[model samples]
Target: MFFEEHTGLHIDDQRYRGSGTSKANRMRGFWTVEPDHVVARVLLAMIAHATEYECVPADMDDALFADVHRIIARLNQNPSSPVPEVDAFTASVNELDFEAAAKHIRTAIEQNEPATAWIACTCFR
Candidate 1:
């Protein structure tokens, strides 16, 4: 919901391209961020560097870091589904081993782990 509100693009609407449905007809389709979108790729790279160095980039301010931490906190609330990589990433962040955290984040993304990737993306975006 936050993403939809911020991006003005619904995830569900991504499926309606060329469907000719009324809702799809009324609005543009394929507007949602794709996993391989340029913005996502650029952010991921920045996150990797920042995490590796354990220092926020000059362009990324304190407020962005706070938002990232908030997102991570929300994700941590749901521990029923155990993801070892996510757990390790969180630990890396806590220990200030940003490079290790970046590694874990990359793995999470490669594994199609949206929650983990979302945390990193939101932080940098």
Candidate 2:
């Protein structure tokens, strides 16, 4: 819903391809020209949306929040770093507990820190 409403990207559950390799150990799923570019785009879009409107209520889950935080911390650590290792980053993202991340986002919104929430959520996405 958020992607559709904010970025016009209507990605459904079925379209969410799994990360990692296939049965043959070959990588699968779509590969962008630059993975970091994709991340930047999503983050920017999220920030723009959050800035333009009131905070929207979202689920807050613990495990997911931890994963999101991990990702964001990595990104923030070296904002100018070249495109990150796609496989490693994807692995980290796949390990996230979506429920926990949702909880974290909700907490951020409740605290009126929508920008932080947006960065976390977008990183996971």
Candidate 3:
């Protein structure tokens, strides 16, 4: 267990050993809570965790970037579906606006097609 070994300390190795930059990025979006304004602290318990499979392998590229955008779109959707971060994310959604990050998310999906779903999932998170 890399996590156990690195408890309170940064091991920065394995699977992502030499790819902290990408790994740092791909690690986000573990949450799946639906959208809502005035985010509720009560939603903190819903945080989701990405699986090792969902970690987005160190080998990512343009196409993979595109897929990440798609995930952002879905996350931006405020869909009826509920995920862990939905509420925590909603609180920040308003702040995250203006940048139109959601638009970027869509563009990444439409323009690039190779981006993996996991990358997209991490994009917004």
Which candidate has the highest TM-score of all?
1
Question: TM-score for all predictions?
Answer: 0.27, 0.26, 0.22
Ranking by lDDT: 1, 2, 3
lDDT of 2 by residue, 9-28 (tens): 44443333454344222112
Candidate 2 vs candidate 3: the TM-score winner is 2
lDDT winner, 1 or 3: 1
lDDT of 1 by residue, 13-59 (tens): 53644555565342333323232232243334446667888786577
Lowest lDDT block of 10, candidate 2: 23-32
Which structure among the candidates has the greatest lDDT? 1
- What root-mean-square deviation over C-alphas does model 2 reach? 17.1
Candidate 1: residue 25 lDDT (0-100): 47
Q: What lDDT score is found at residue 85 in candidate 3?
A: 34
